[model samples]
Target: MKIIRSKSFTGERAWAALDIANMNGITTRLHWTDQPYKWHTNDGEEVFVVLDGQVQMRYRDLGVEREVLLEVGDIFYASVGTEHVAHPVGAARILVVESEGSV
Candidate 1:
């Protein structure tokens, strides 16, 4: 079995991710970032979990922009067709589960 230590995880670049699982047409990943991700809609749905640090999560609903602060242990769910982006407060580690090959 492989084990990961989230606290010591770092990437060569922002938003770098490591695949944890790829099964049943779904993918689970561990991501490290210190930058904002571009807004985009998922192919299916997405479940985001903050493992370390904080994030400013922005989304659009009814053409209106909104944002929320996601702290450690917080979770964010994005339904299909939901436009959203994430900006880290600094360096952060996030666990993301989504449809395989989705962006």
Candidate 2:
């Protein structure tokens, strides 16, 4: 059992994550970032949730690029093969859930 205060969290790098759990084969993590993540596709699905601040979520759909502003409490679900990247508006805290070893 564990209790975490996600509201007060920071990281050393652009996307520093604190592992919270691993159920079945999925991993749940809390991440802190102030920079954009590299554009890439996850082998499995990904669930991105904004816990604090805002983010500009960029992705390509059917060869067309798009972006969405994600604020606190917003969630973005990226299915398998979905090429996407996240650009935090500033310092933001996010919760991510995906396959344990997915890239």
In order, what lDDT does every prediction score?
A: 0.96, 0.96
Estimated TM-score for each candidate: 0.97, 0.98
Alpha-carbon lDDT of model 2: 0.96
- Write one digit per residue (lDDT tens) for candidate 1, span 1-103: 6798888888999999998888898999999999999999998999999999999999999999999999999999999999999999999999999999899
Query: Taking the tens digit of each residue's C-alpha lDDT, what string does model 2 give over 1-103?
Result: 9898999889989889999999999999999999999999999999999999999999999999999999999999999999999999989999999999887
The list of candidate 1 runs beyond 4 A from truth reads: none
Model 2 regions more than 4 Å off: none
Please state every model's RMSD to the true fold in angstroms.
0.7, 0.6
lDDT of 1: 0.96
